[model samples]
Target chain A: MRMPKLTAFLMATAVFASALVASADEVHVLNWKGYGADEPWAIAAFEKATGNKVVNDFFNSEQEMLTKLRTNPGLYDVVMINAAFNDQAMAEKLIQPIDVSKIPNYADISADKAGSPMLARDGKVYGVPWVWGLTALAINEKAFETPPTSIAEMWNEAHKGRVTIRDDAVEAVQFGAIATGQNINDIKDMEAVKAKLTSLMPQIKTFWSSENDWNQMVASNQIDIGTYWSGSADRAKTHFKLPVSLVIPREGAVAWLDAFSIPVGAKNVAGAEAFINTMIDPKFYVEWVTKVGAPVSANAKAVAALPEDAFNRKVMGDPGVAKRIQFQAPISDAQREAYLALWQELKVNVK
Target chain B: MAGQVATGARSGLRSALPLLVPAYLWLTVAIFMPLSAMVFFSFMTELPLSGKAWSFTLDNYATFFAQGLYRTLLLASLKLGLEVTLWCVVIGYPAAYVLAKVFRGRSREAIFLLVILPFWSNGLVRIFSWAMVLREGGILDTALNAVLPFKINIDLMYSYPAVIIGLVHSYVPYMVLTCYLTLQAIDDSLIEAGRSLGASRLQMLKRVIIPLSMPGLVAGAALIFVPVVGSFMEPRILGGRTGTFYGTIIEDQFVAVFNWPLGAALSFILLAVVLVILALASPVLKRAA
Candidate 1:
């Protein structure tokens, strides 16, 4: 009787341990809503392939994402952070260096993105560069006889009361920096930037805050030319059928990258790696790009696999464009406050 | 006799304690605790939870005093509040008088529903709907151009007037609802007495209706003015580049610039100003009561 009871107890322990292991396979993801990670089909495919369940939470802004990570340590196994904020995340120890070996698809990522200083620290990779896009000029094709070649066209008298820009201090300051022939990440003369933005104010009909706002403003002819995202511009033209064309001016454009990283003290590190690998897979990239209209894939193989006339392939595929692009860098808190103050002052004086 | 009264009062307190416990507990948890925490944070140099080195500092409040922009925007917001409140009163008082004095039975109920209809829809959808009506080739423009002999462009989107229109549309219902309640409560005999005294219809309204409805009018103005002073959304959606206000700047400090300490300070300042305004209006409100 004693032997039989002991055997039954051992069996129960084995079953409970297996259940624990199964529960541990679940991956919690933090990302922007609708930004590739939480796609239903992708999540289903990843779950089926790796036998790991995926759950997602979304943040509306990058700062909100940071706050979430800081407040909820060990809750999120995977997080999507912008390249510009990678250093700050790393410094705060919010995310850990990802083991690239676990992500087999990492080999196919473009060297420029994979090796970017923004994603690495002291020879260790903290993030897997996922997607990139440009914040360049998007113009109403029907409104212009010829495409604008320079960022200075935003100030042209012809487009007065027909031009717009985003209502963001960082974007406005960066645009000013670019127009003044200064690096976006490093501006030596903020006075020049302030002066440039102040002059552009009268030409602006309005300022858009979201992709929907941009679409409405342009569709109604409330604006003729404005600073817009490349991916959003592509969606406007292809999905909404708006007569919009993105222009990479002679002064180049502001570029930003988004990456997937494992949060520090995550319970399911392997599951997080598996999810990120699936996220950057070429097949997934092609589907996301063609159907949903996403930013350009960081994976070189994925871009090459897209159709010849794919908007990203036609516009951002050139190596020369890569050289001209200025990838955003981490901004100090003091610098951000200064930009905000200047932007607010300019908005107050716009009329 | 005093001792007996004190005993009675103690017994009354003992009886009411159980009923008041839940309410006081809720207030302590939901309102006072958070407000106390905000007060503490307003004096800090940084967010204490951000894992950064921080200490108590008066710099946050000092920045407000040193900067002229905050004062300018706060004044602008006050002006906006005053304009919106006056418009609500001008538009709503007459409608309320009609609802209370003229309309009867089912027609009154139907019109009353129409007055409160703006509350049925989401605030954003309503604002956007106004945008559709007020844009250049929008409903208003299209209708006007279709009926008129000459082509007149009505590009009101992204202007100050658009913001005012959207805000007034949103808040006028408050004025109507409050004034209607008060006007309905006033004895109809008062108006009859005024008219029997050989008063004109206008004189009857000025003497009998307006004075009696003062409570509701004061209540409605307070309701509209408080929110409008701190409003950021309607102004943003409709006012375009012209939309930057004190409230929007405070929003920027927290969300865009990650300056929570400064945001807390600015918020505290706005709260203090609002309190002072309410304090100044208390005598009038009490008199109306």
Candidate 2:
């Protein structure tokens, strides 16, 4: 009798375990930490709604993201890629085109963001546009009585030793291109960009590499003005109560779009699509932007749902600001290497 | 007799092979294999794993030689390594002497722990702490202003000196620990004899104590100089705009530019430079030993 009872219990446990495994599919997501896909609350909501469990991995840089995708094939079900890198991912065959019909919310993406050349190859959409933001000038509210309107303020002799910029090669070159009244994506005059950046070096107090570093510098009064991300500026101002205000100068700012892509050979394509769709849902976007600061949503309906005074809307809502924005484009590997070499050379010569 | 000796040696080797296998296997997997792979990759045109076109090429190495920037940065890193090692010796030698010769029993143990306390925390945290003390409105500036009659700005953040200070703080413990081991092993009677023979304190330190501890000093210098020469974090965190170095440039090649071949060549070049430096120092090290 005791043996029979034990057998019955063992069989029951096996059945329950199999039931649990069959009902929930685990989706592995690779993204930047704190990005929408990784937020605990969003993950919980997705799991509850779709019976799909979300697991997250994070990368610090877009290059690192690509490295992970290349090296760990089939390990990640979903990856968040900057649109500028989507072409490279497709060329490497690391990510697959998403079937937009599977993602109901994909249609809600803003028309401009939907038509991004980087996200699609030929006709199929390889990436689902998620968020967009600007790398623009942010100033200490206390330092500027009237907000500066020109990118040239960074090089003004009066602000010498009080200015800063990011330490990325691509961003720095794009910034220099803008300052020289050239297109960020297609600058014809390399020498002019080089000369303009070199002249700005004396005015630079230092270079910041991360959002945390930028905030620390501002909080300690280390720098009064610097190039910073629009979303991060909102967080610094509203969440941390930092005295910073993001400004889109007349010369324009560099715009970047991030997207969610399903990696080729992903085991759980259905689960990955569900996760992406849920992330773009207006309900989720509104909650994410209102509670935790984020880049402007790519879903037009989600943007409309945001409060009238939302930080993203106030700064990015103006159509004129959109006209002035220069979206980053795919840069060839050789061009990127040249930019890196030039940036390194410039940094080495800094006194 | 020679045949018998050879047979005996062969038997000894056969017996020892089993005991040596694990260690050799570990070394092959951990050190030799990775190094061989890097050397192989350094000669390639592109990373084979990237599914890109590839070929054997010397362009990576050629780029390093053709560009004067790499050479300049390498020299700067060597200079930084030398300066930091010197500061470590200056600050650490005295403290090590006190721990080895002056303090006794429990006091010695307590003070020794204090010397190595910095290692308990993360290197990044320690560097950040120095930033707190060295920044313009930091603790040092506040304390100085309170005492001094005139106002003075003491901003050291993002400066070369700040980098030097942070590095010394992080590595001085190595000098102290190594020197302490050798200094403690020296017989006190030798010092007493030197004193009895009319050698002054300075002369005793220069002639007896230093010579006896030369092995430890050289070891500490080697340990500190190698890592300091390749250091990128402290310089990046502290030196700011002026922080560009050979190490950081190599880091960019691998992470930023995805130029693994160039990064590998650069790394091998740095390894060669370090090996040459060690080879130069071996004569002194052997003499001291």
Candidate 3:
């Protein structure tokens, strides 16, 4: 009994010393929902690859993420935000720049977009590209006998009571601006946005906050057609037997990209960079896209490496479609305020 | 004799002090401090000349009231609240009675549990589940087309009805519990006496139960009405872009607009409006009393 006790004590001491010597790291990643699969397998793979724990948090809107950060700084280590808000965050010293030399996997991003003037500002690097796509109106094939082709057709009387719109202020106003031949970048007054929404509101069945609304609308055939992200069509198609088409309006569409940025006061900067690089790794990149069920910003190598069927999915059809999708730059503060004020009025007065 | 009476009074005061301390502390810590901060901040604005630091301003209030949009939302929110409260009362009263009176013991508990089962999950989860059911390819349509070979455009995901239904579902459990406690506490003899007087079933329920349950009903109504007026999630989630309630306006000022002053001023205005409503309703409540 004494000999057995001594052996057990020695084993316990050895294990304790090993644990003390083991390197441990944690990376706090903030992004949208469906980015990380809330499964043990996914987390374990990430942890095993780079001895770090990733803490995932989700935000509903670009405003929501920035609102929390502005109200309280240093709360998040890394936050995924839009290009428009990131400018504000950088100006406020709320977030820091990613060291370009540290991110070798960024080279894997497509050649066409590698040097695009859209990603940088004032010779400094800020945002890393996340989502690459155009906003298109998703047509519910079952709801309409003849699918609405022209952007103006969404306002047609035939689909009056059974149409839905998203709650985004910029998309609705920008899309309407395009149709009206108004320069979207140069809108001054709130009146124009209100005018656009007031016209659009009468025909809308509802306004959706999330992509779930689009998925449900197309699947259920409740609203005939709706403005949605290109990725939404792909998700809707998987769930619904109906052939959902991306209607790129002649008027033009609001392009969007979500990006990852480290906060200026990030404690685990090295670990955060490591996690980002790992995410861009080909196998992990494919897994995230496959599981996420969305389009990607990864260059040809990553896309080429994907399984044949997954790679050839209709979501990423033409590379040129991406260029047509404009990015949201930092609009003047006055214009941003005008847009929001107009959006609020449209909410109340819309019949 | 004077000293004896004074000591007795002091002891009485001392004994009651512990019980009341918590209530005061609860309100002070949870409600008063935060509200005071918000009130303070409402007057505070970032003056560009002074940099990012907040400065005193009434521009927030001026902006809120100057526009008709802000006030309109308050009215819409109140309307939505009142409408939902009425539905909750109508639906909750019978459901509570069936669980409390018709069903007894474990079965009663089971029925009550079933009503509360959604609460155990999450309000958001249930709303999304409804979205799945009511959407074009939702379970309802799937089940419907299976039975009847037909198609219909019944997308109920992002309309006014969605918010209403979601709000009522979230609050109906509270209504049921309040009504249940009120009904259960009633003297059976009063009900029996009504029956003895040769009153019909509906008459006894109308005369005895409703009047007796009025206090709980009134309290529950007030509880639901106040929060329902401030409901932000339901409008954003269910109403989508198709429809909106007043909560969205409040959210706009603070989040999207970054106009905290205006949001706070608008909130105060809304408070006054609700108080006015409750004040006006007091007469009806007194009559019920």
Candidate 4:
């Protein structure tokens, strides 16, 4: 009376392999941190809708992901790279020109979400936007009598030995320049950036390397304020039950997007398109953002269906917020070397 | 004494040349070849590709000298290496002595097996196991928190002290094994003869037992100190980004920083430091023997 589980298993295995060996039934994907890990709803829906298994690999940085895709010709079906890297990936013939006709759910995504740097390029859609966020000043209201307003306030004498700066070169250098009203994009102006940083360095209790770090410093009032990503700031608030306000500074901010695109060598074109379509579903998008604490740019109606407070608190919801922020593009290889060299110099020269 | 040692050494070498040649060849191919490549790259601003060598430049050398990071990190590693060696020497000597002297047959094997338990486990896992014990809100913290009336939670992970502790824990077994071998090699009759001479318990240990153990102590110190100086992980995990030793910067330059030439130059600088330490240590070893 019992159906054979082994038969079902064999069928599933055949389908999975054909997706890899053949080109139609499996979606080979690459995405960055916190984006591609097992999301049960997305996986189930994608499989059911398209009869495709979503085979995914994760990359930590845009540099690594882009480099891998560039060096390897046709290994991946779909790769999620930032808008900045799309130029190189195109120039190198690393990515396939995405066929929007293959992906139908692309129509459902609104104008605002599609306009993200990673998804839209030169009047053509290359990818779909996933996570868009800004690095900001996280203020612990419980620690301070009055929380500071902007990035500059974090380095004020009152916050001495209580402010934590991120160890990231881009965030530290950009926030330093932006807080002081300098062009954050100009890497050549090291003296101006260094001057601002050297002044602020002493005020910083410690430089944080990982997002998981600085929780104790902020929560326990050892550090009253710090440079933090929105997800981290929100989690700190939720975990410690502290009134942590994630503040985007007056002097511009940094915005980044993780996007998915098919690589040139992709074996499973149909499956990849199916997976991308599955990700765009309003119901799936709503569940992902709510669970993951990252507001992915998706269907507005789906996002609106969430609780009012949760929707409002979603950092990605503010249009003006994104406008003020600059997204990083892969600088020319020469400039990248220069930036790293300069960063090394900065680390040595500063405390 | 020098002449005697030289002749004796020559005889020993002649006898062991067949065994020594294979080891020497292995060391050259495995270690020296890579080392020479690094040294060569240190002098080059850019690496040779397609059988073409880049123009030799000392920018890496200059960076090493100018930034003075090499010096600071080199000095930090040296200080930590010495501390780690001292820790192993202090802890391992007595433990090794107990294993060799007090325990015998099956009991000795069990105790020695206990010492080797950590060795059987992966080095990273062992260090992490210690991290689990020592880190804040970890095993030790929970235990202390339960017993202590106040916040006596010792924030052990991401501290220099924790690294020193981890280094000591990770490599102490090597020190124990080295010392135990030397202790075992000592004839039991010599210890008896010292006792028979009516030397005090302390005198017997100092005059007879300790002199024989000097070689083990020195060997153990070398094993612990040299590798610990070049260690990257223990310090990085334990220190966090608050700061790190010299090794971390060197690693970042190669892997993440993507400046192999600079990293190579730093490697040579570290190698020089190692050579200097070994040169300094040679005299102490000679005197001990």
Candidate 5:
């Protein structure tokens, strides 16, 4: 039994070794599922124009991406990471500085969004904003005739078994702080946050990790209200044909930005730059945002090109919408450790 | 004659070396080296790979003892393991008995194959399939409601029970396969002998058949319990809000918190617990063997 398996393994290893040695003109990209160059047109058009094939790989989180880049050097050309992780990525030198000159489309970014600290370090641009969205309440209109207006509704006894919260420690703790009338960014009393999270345990039917998890819960009528991403809400409504809509509660929502950057040991720098430029093209952004459902575009031309009834225009054009949503901010490792500890306590106490 | 025998034994050893070396080499590279590395890393304050300034510390293990939450979560995971294994035994043993004893000829072979068929598909996909069947307005609900006179809510998704159901469904096949092999190996004449010696049906089952199949029960229990203790995905997908366990926290350390040292320590602790359980069970297992 083992002899046959051993022979087969040896044969397979020989095949893979040869495959790795064979050179190809391809820009290997590492990103989140369904993100940049994952679109057929982006890959097809890039390959047609640049004569470089696109290879895509994905990770579920920034930490996983960082680990891959650190461990598997030269495996990926372009990577998309959360804006909040730019400092750590730079400090570790896992990613290299961006050559803005090579990417002419860098000028397409709006001044306000371009000022993000994640974009520049030591006066050198590192990454370009790829997509941005907010974590807010996604309610099924069929379940809620009047949309919920506050994060407090997540704890309402009336909807005890219909509420789904995010499973993320930072997001859950931040929202817990927000629900208890504290600034989410500057959490002073972790005990208070943990207490708040513990109190809401009875109300949550389940905790979801991904946008697809939230969508499935709502689509199947398993959950009526959830802490969901705005982009996911749009996708769920269109794809699942569910009566779901995203509403930023009175306590506000956490906004996050993902940016494209070149890894330190990229073999195809020119191809990687071309891919990023192609991703930010106004025409591409317009079609990308509309079809894929992004909350907003960082590209000035793309933002201006939105139609009157477009999802981004309606959401981003609202007065003080940008101010109301709290952008993703970096936290000290000590704070992160403290928050994780409290999160453990909250989870353990979830009887 | 003694010198010739010694030369023959030496040749036998040389012949076996080629096969034995590969297996031991594989074990050293795959299991032993990683375990040693994990142990070494568990003593560090930070990851050594990043070339960041780091120092040796016992804080990772210390933190496990410092927090009551970790202890509680470990106990909960152990309880979950027990619950799942017990359910597997309750559900799988009867099916194994039916297939081995009651079913005959072509049907027995087909039924045995059908019992283990779910194992062929992806475990993750099978777990997710249960989500579809157990969720609100799902297949089970729709089917039951269609047959019943009165409408009723039958949603079981996201609850603790759903996690148990999904795990049992996923692991029951292992128990069935193990128990079936042992049950089939037991001579039917021995069971008949027990019955002919004034033993009732229950006595024959409890005395002759069950004692003979103890090895299979122990083997299946060990198989199910070890993985169940380390399981995170099943709870996450099926348990919903109630899914957090020791395994998930260990997952969070490596993936979410970027705390490799702490994760390693936690994993080591879980390994110790599993070793202790197996050690305690070894006596009974030896007797059965």
Candidate 6:
């Protein structure tokens, strides 16, 4: 009787141990494509170090990501959201405040980026700065004898019908404001924005919406200059061998920063924190920046550690280049509506 | 016997339910439910799914009136649709007529397949392919430059003409297919009869062939016009900066601006306009049928 009881106890212990071994801590990350720590070595090391698995879901745009997060609460443990959208995400209680104590590498981020209002709210830190990029002017190098240095160059009569702009209303309106020497951020006066944007109509050959479309135009010599992300121009030159170059106009460019935030009701907060820390590890950041081309990492050590080759792309690792970036502040919902309304009018009257 | 007949009719319906249910159920779930939901959401202040404060309001519709932009864009889109449909009719009807009446046997079948071969591949990819042909220094440019003594620049990449070309190319196949279907059913005897009655070829075509094929023409026009009016992708890819339409604005609301209620209102209004158009065309269609 004693022997049989001991055998049953051993069998139950074996079953319980198997269950424990099967269930690993998981961190579900919602981010843009190519934004996550996608390197095999990084992923493997992370999994081995923390015994947690990272699963990723990607969104093409901020609004799409917002829609997914808003519709499915607690679905994602970690989200890499645009800094401009952090306010709205927090206001809606979609994401929760971060405990800095849980993320040790959070301290290694540059002070300027760390102290930005985008990552903090009500004196409580909400996000860890991840990567930074800019939406600047991309020009075909062969189109002009000299490099254009000002945003106003886009509207010059000489380049009439040879230029393109992004098909984004806010960005277009902001550029218009900047061009006309009006405040890009506040944008209180609708008529001013309208007048400025409408003045650009004669010069615009077309408005491109996608990077691929812009690249094709450049390759086919359809447009002399256009508005696209700075990193995309770098990628195009390196990958497609396009004769394109990115320019930061004297009027300043709209800069965006992406950061990692934990959503409210996240099932694995600890694992999410670990994943965020792992992402900012200098070794991982180096690999990420090297592989992904020239988007700056917020971590100072990572920037310092980048080899001369990756560091040569001054836009990526140079702090001086970052100073030229004018970060876009979050806008009120009403402002968004008014801007879209005016933009629609501008589009209708483009001819 | 009357009771037996009633029972037979009931049994027929019962047997048909299985076949009808799958399709009707799919339509109800996929089409009707979303459409009804859109109408319901159009009257709201905010998206209820967002868990934000919201209320019922017609201000969304009122904005359409308060601002004339939506109406203007809608008019522009309709004009685009009309232009594309007319071009397709001019270009496609003749090709379709040849396919139906001119050629015979294997060649006709093969040509018909070639005409619609584009529809098989992805629509977006096909639109992109046109960029290689229509843009500056593209196939058309290289070909033209190769033959001409002097250089003549051909840069239609982001122009209104480019948009029209892309749209017509995308939708002309519909015209061919529909016109071919109806034109094929017309008997040769009717043409011979018209000829015997002292009618000329043009007269026979104008009075007989055209009138007989009115159903296909109307059907093709409706089919082409509806989608073209709602097209945003073709214009974006081919029209460049010149490509904002009513459909693109509606798209902006959902994806760019994150305003579902407003987008829903815009979509619902578009649906109403489309329904009215289809309604107006129904009488002519019925007569032709």
TM per candidate comes to: 0.93, 0.92, 0.77, 0.78, 0.89, 0.91
Among residues 3 or more apart in sequence or in different chains, the pairs in candidate 1 whose N, CA or C atoms overlap within 3 Å are none
**Cα-lDDT of candidate 6:** 0.81
Q: Predictions ranked by DockQ, top down? A: 5, 1, 6, 2, 3, 4
- Across A11-108, the per-residue lDDT of candidate 5 in tens digits comes to 53454354342134788888877764698876888899999988877776666677667766776788887888887888888889988889888898
Best by TM-score: 1
For candidate 3, give the docking quality class from DockQ: acceptable
Per-residue lDDT tens digits of candidate 2, residues B247-268? Answer: 8888788768778789889988
lDDT of 4 by residue, B33-128 (tens): 666766787788664521224788878888777856567777888888999999898899899999998889999999899998988888778776
- Clash-forming residue pairs, model 6: A206-B241, A207-B240, A207-B241
| Predicted candidate 5 versus true structure: per-residue lDDT over B1-289, tens digit per residue | 4355446778876776786788889888656766787788899998865456799999999989988888888998999999999999999999999999999999998998888789899988998899889887999999999999999988898889998999899899989989998999999888888877899988888888888998898899999998898888898888877888988898888767778889988988998898998999899788876
Measured by DockQ, the strongest candidate is 5
Off by over 4 Å in 6: A1-24, A38-41, A309-313, A316-323, B1-8, B284-289
- Interface root mean square deviation per prediction: 14.5, 13.4, 14.6, 12.7, 5.6, 15.4
Kindly report which residue stretches of model 5 are placed more than 4 angstroms away from their true locations once superposed.
A1-28, A50-57, A68-78, A93-103, A262-273, B1-8
What is candidate 3's lDDT per residue for A78-122, written digit by digit as tens?
677776677777777778877867877887776545444444667
lDDT string, candidate 1, B112-147, tens digits:
999999999999999999999999999999999999
Q: Quote the positional error of residue B262 for candidate 5 in Å.
A: 1.7
Candidate 2 C-alpha error for residue A349, in Å: 0.7
DockQ of candidate 5 is: 0.40
Q: Is 1 or 3 the stronger prediction by DockQ?
A: 1
* lDDT, residue B202, model 4: 92
Cα shift from native, residue A70, model 5 (Å):
4.0
lDDT of 6 by residue, B99-206 (tens): 999999999989989998999989878888887889888889899999999999897777789999999998999999999999999999999999999999899999
Angstrom error at residue A261, model 2: 2.4
